[model samples]
Target: MREISFSVQALTAGYGNIPVVRDVTFTLPKGTILTLIGPNGAGKSTILRTISGQLSVLSGTVMICGKALSGLSPAALAREMSLLLTDRVRPEMMTCFEVAAMGRYPYTGRFGRLTAGDRQIVRSALARVHADDLAEQDFLAVSDGQRQRVLLARALAQEPKILILDEPTSYLDIRQKIELLSILLEEARERQLTIVMSLHEIDLAEKVSDLVMGIRDSCVFCSGTPEEIFAGDTIRHLYGIQEGTFLTRTGSIELPRTRGNSRIFVVGGAGFGLPFYRALTRKRIPFSAGILFENDLEYGTALSLAVRVHSVPAFARTMETAFGEAEKDLLACQAVLDAGTRIGETNAANARLLASARSAGIPVWRTIHEQD
Candidate 1:
C-alpha cells in the first residue's frame, strides 16, 4: 500500500472555542495534490491553519507521515511542511532574496545565517518559480504576482515533504496562475512532495488536483476525485448557483438562457456558436440553437445560453428528424446566425440548415450583432 503523506481525521478548527469547520477528514498519498474548494467563509483557511499548527485544533487530529501534528516540535514540523499563507507581509528594506532565504531557517546554524550552499538553494528556488530576476528587488515593491512567486520560492527553499498553500493563485493573472500551478504539479511528480491547497478557481482545481474536497456549512460537503465530484449538478449545488448554468465538461459557467419565446434561430456546430449564444443571452434575446452533436464542444454552452437546442447523437450522421425540427424553428425566427462552424461530414446538417434559412428569405448573419 502507498504511504499516506498527510491525513486529517474529524478535525474541527477555528479561532478560540468557536468552530468554523468541523468533521473534515481526508488522506493523501505521497506526491498527490489535494484541493479544497467552497464558497467564501467556508473555513478553507481555518482547515489549512489547523493543519499547519498555526490555529489550535478543537477536535480530531492531523497526522503528518504517521505522526500526530501536535506531538511534533516546531522545528521538526518545519522540516516536514512549508506554508504559503494569504496574510500580507510588508518587510521594510528586505530584498526578495532575503525573504526567500528565510525558508532555510530551520536548517540554519544557531546564528540563523545562510551559508554558500543555503544561498544556492535560495537562488535555485527563485529560479524555479521564475522570480530569480526579482531576487535583489525590494520585496514590498514588487507586484502582487511577483510577490506570490517569491513567497512560493520561499516555501520551496524549505525542502519539505508537504507544501500548504492558501489561495496561492489569488493575485496572479491567468498566465501566472497557470505557470505557478504547472510548477507545483511538476514538483509534486518529480520530488514526491505532497500538496494541499485552497483554490477559488474550481476550473483550475479540477484540472490539476488528484483529489478534490468541497466544504460548506462547517463540514466536508463532498470529497472525491474531480471526475466524481464534478459529475451532474454537484458544482452548482456546491456553490448554490441559481441564476446561471455550470458546464461540468469545460468547467465554464454561462448566464441563464434568455426566457420566453426564442425570436432568433442559430445554426451552430463544432463549438462555433458559444460567443454568439452568450451575446444573444446578454441582449436578453431568446434564441434557439440546432444541429449540434451531443458530444460537440459547444453543446453544453448551447444548452446553457439557448432557449432550446436541437441535438443528435455524437458521431452519427445528422438525422432527418432533427433537421426537420431545426428547420421549423429557423422559419419561426426573424434571422439565422451562422457561427461559421467548419463544414464537415458530421456537421453537414448545419450547412443544410443554413441553406434552408436562405431559401426561406430569412436574413443570415455571421455575427450576432449583424442581425437586422
Candidate 2:
C-alpha cells in the first residue's frame, strides 16, 4: 500500500471542553491534497487548527508519518509539518526575508539566530514562491497578494512533509488565486507534499483536490473523491443553498433565472450558448433555449438560466423526428438567436429552426441584445 503521510481518526476539535467539529476521519498518501468545504461557521478552520497543533484536539488522534501527533516531540513534528493559518499577523517592521526565516525555528540554535545555511534556505523559499524580489522590502509595504506569497514561502521554508493551510486564497484576486493554487499543485506533485486546507471556492476545490470532505452541523456530511462527492444535490444540501444553486458542470453557484415572458428563443449547442445565456441574464431578458443535446457543454447553463429549455437525449437524431416543442417554442418568441452552432448530422434540426423563423417572418439574428 502507498504510505499514508497524514491521517485523522475520529477527530473532534473545539475550545474549552466543547466540540465544534466531530467524528472527522480521513487519510492522505504522500503528494495528496485534501480540502475541507462548508458554509460559514462550519468548523473547517477549527479542524485545521486542531490537526496542525494550534488548537488541542478534544478527542481522536492525528498521525504524522505513522506516529501519533501527540507522541512526536515538538521539534520532530515541526520538521514534519508546515502550517499557515488565516489569523492576522502584524509583523513589526520585519523584512520579508526575516519573516520567512522564522520557519527555520525548529533547526535554529538556542540563540534563535539564523545561520548562513538558514538564510540560503529562506532566500530559496522566497524565490520558489516568486517573492524573492520582495525579500528586502518591509513585509507591510507589499500588496496583499505579495504578502500572501511571502507567507506561503515561509511555510515552504519549513521543508516539511505535510502542509496545513486555512483559506489560503483569501485576500487574493482571481488571477492571483489561480497562480497560488497552480503553484501549490505543482509543489505537491514535485515534492510529494501532503496538504490539508479549507476553500470557499468550490470550483477550484473540485479542480485541485485529491479528496474532498463536506462539513455540516458539526460533523462530516460526506467524504469521497471530487467525482463522488459533487454529484447530484450534494453541494446544494451541504451549504443549505436557497438563494442560488450549485451547478455540477461549472462547479459554481448560479442565482435563479429571471422570471417573465420568455420572449426570446435561442438556438444554442456545444459551448456557443453560454455567454449568450449570461448576457441575457445580465440584461434581465427572459429567454428560452432549446434543441440542445443533454451532454452539450452549455446544456447545464441553459437549464440554470433559461425558463423553458427544450432538450433531447445526448447524440440522438431527435432533431429530425422530434422537433415538436422546439417548433412550438419558435413560434412564441419575438426573436431567435442562432448561437452559430455548426450544422451536423445529429443537430440538423437547428437549421430547420432558422429556416422556419425566416419563413414565419419572425426576426432571426445570429446575435441578440435588449433594445436600449
Candidate 3:
C-alpha cells in the first residue's frame, strides 16, 4: 500500500484571527492526484494556503510525512513540499529557464551556486514541461500558457514529495489546459509525486484526479474517487445547478436537461404557421414535423429544435389530395410512434395526422394558438 503523504486533522485556518476553513480533515496518500473543487469564496484557496504553510493554522494538526508541519522551519518545510500559487509575479528580464531554476533555491548554498546535479534536475524539469526549446526566451514575453508550464517546471525542480497548486490552468486555453493536466497526471504517476490542486473546471477535475474534495458552506462535504463524488445528486447540490444531468455511461460531462414535450407535429405548410410554433417553444415541450412546404414557417421552427421531419410535396389542399401526397409522411410518423413519442396537430384539416399515432396508443394533446 502507498504511504500517506499528508494528513490534515481538525484543521482550522484563515488570516489575521478569522477562520475561513473550519475543522477540515482528510488524508492524502502518496502519488495520488487529488482535486479541490468548490464555488468561489468557499475557502478552497484558504485550505491550500494553510496546507502549504503560507498561512498559520489557527488550530489542529497538518502532518507531512509523519512530521508536524506547524513545528517545521520555513526552509525545512520547503524541502518537503512545493506550492504553485495562482498569483505569480514574473521577473521582467528572466528567461523561462532562469525562472524554473529558482525552484532549486531551497537546496542551494548561500552563494546560490548550481551544482552539476542541480543543473540536471532543472534541465529535466524544463523537458518535463516540453519547454526546453524556450529556455532562453524572456518569461514576460511568453504567452500565459507557456508561463504556466514554466511555473510548473519550477515546482517540479524542487524535487519535493508533495506539490500543491492553486488553479494551475487559470491562464491556459482549453487545449493547453488539457495538455498541462495530462502532463501533471503522467509525471505524478511516473515519479510517485503526490499532487493536490484546486480547479474550477468540473469536467477536468473529474477526468484526471483520483480523489475529489468538495467544499461547500464552510465544511468539507465529501472526499473520494471522481465516480463517487460526481454522482447525480452530489453535483446537483454541490454546484446548485438543478438543470444539470450527470450521464450514467459517460461518467464525466454534465448534460443540460431538455424539456420533454408531450405532443406536437405538423404536416408542414406556409402562413399556416408562426402562431402555433411560438406556442410550442413557449411551452417548452418536445415536437415533431413532416410534409412541409419549402418555405413553411412550421417547418422552420421544427428544424430549429432538431426534431425529426419528413419531406413531401410543397402544397396539399383537400383531405384526399393532401393525405395522398402525405402518405410518406404518415409512414414516417410510424417510427416516431415506435419510439413512444406523442403526436398532435393544430388545424382541423391536418388533425387527421394524429389518428395513426393515436391508433398506435401514443398519447396526443391538441391545442391551437393565434399568432400576434
Candidate 4:
C-alpha cells in the first residue's frame, strides 16, 4: 500500500474570467500512478499546471507533505515535484545533455559548477530513459519523441518525489509511446515515486493507471480505479461514444469496434441464446432478439448487444402469437429467409419457423443440443 501525499480541496483556476477547472478536489497517494483523462477542453492541462505551481490557484487549497503549497516558491516546489509539459521549443545551441542538466539549477551552487554527484545524477537519469546515446546530439536536431524522452530525463534529474506530465506521448509513434510510458512505469515502481499525468490515449491510461480521474462539463465527473472508470457506462459517457461494448478478456480491457449491420435474429429464452449471441459478436456479426417473458441469461445479453426486443403478452393461455404481432415477425423473418437470408430458431414452439425455413429451402440452425 502506498502512502497518501497531496490532499487538494475545491481547487479552481483559469486563464482569466473563464474558469476551466471548476471546484475540483482529489487526493494523490505516493507510489501510485494516477491519470487525468477527458475530452479536449476538459481542463486536464490546467490541473497539471496549477498543481506544479506554474499557474496560480484562483481558489481552494493545494497541500503537499501536509504544508500549504500556495505561497511556496517555484524553485522550492521544483525540489518536491517535477513538471514535464508538452510545449517543446529547443534552444539554438543546447545539447541534449545540457538541456537535461538544467534540472539541477535549483540545487546548484552560486558558481554553477557541476559537482561529481550532479554529473552522476544527470547520467543516471539519461540512461534510465534510454536517452544516453542521444546526450551529445543537438536538441534542435532530435525528433519530437526523442526530445520528449530527454525532457523526461531532465525531470528525473531533479530527484523530485512526484512527477507531473501533460500529454507526454503526444507526437510520438506507437513504439515510442509504449517505450516512454514503460519507462515512466518502471521509475514509479522502482523508486516508489508518485506520478500524475494527463493523457489522450484512454486505453493506455486505463491499462497503466492505478486510479483514473475523468472530467466532463467542466467538473470532475468520476474518479476511481481504472476498472471502474473504464466500465461500459462511464467510458461511453466520457467519450460520447454511442455504440460499442466494453470487453474484458483474460483480465484485460478492450474496446474493439462494435460497428456493423449483421442484425441476426436470435429466438431462444432460458439461457439458450448466450453462446450464439457471443459467437456472433466475436465474429463481428451484429444480432437482435426478443419475446423474453421472464428473467433469462440471454435477456441481459440481448440488451447488452442492443438487440431489438418485441415482448410476448404475459399470462397468455397458449404458446401462440399475441395480437398477430408474432405472426408479423414470422412473416418478416420468412421474407428475409425467402431472399436467402440466414435465420435460426430453438425449442418446439419456434421450431415451426425452422420447419418453414426448411420448406422454403432456407438454412436454419438448431441450438437444441449445442447451446451454451
**By TM-score, who's the top model here?**
1
- Model 4 is weakest, by summed lDDT over 10 consecutive residues, at 334-343
C-alpha TM-score for every candidate: 0.95, 0.93, 0.72, 0.71
In candidate 4, what are the lDDT values of residues 1-372, reduced to their tens digit?
Answer: 457777689999677656787888878777789899998888999888887788888889988767778767877887888979888566999999998998888889997677889989999999999999999999999998899999999999999988999999889999999999999899888997889999988888988898899987788988999988876577668866655544422122233434444344556566566566566667776544544543444455555663354445444343355324543454444222111122233223454544554676545555335322
Candidate 1 Cα misplacement greater than 4 A, ranges: 344-348, 367-372
Model 4 steric clash total: 0
RMSD of 3: 11.3
Model 2 C-alpha lDDT versus the unseen true structure = 0.89
lDDT of every model, 2 decimals: 0.91, 0.89, 0.74, 0.73
Residues 1-372, candidate 1, lDDT per residue (tens digit)?
Answer: 678999999998999999999899999999999999999999999999999999988999999999999999999999999999999989999999999999998999999999999999999999999999999999999999899899999999999999999999997899989998999998899889899999999999999999999998888889999999999988998988898988998999788778988899888776678888888988999999987889988999998888889998887865465988888888999999988777777777778888988998999988533322
Worst 10 residues of 1 by lDDT: 363-372
Question: CA shift at 224, candidate 2, in angstroms?
Answer: 1.0
* Candidate that beats the other on TM-score, 1 or 3, i.e. the better one: 1
lDDT of 2 by residue, 258-366 (tens): 7887888889888888888888988989999988989999888889889888888887866655488789888889999888777788898888988998999999888
Could you tell me which 10 consecutive residues in candidate 3 have the lowest summed lDDT? 334-343
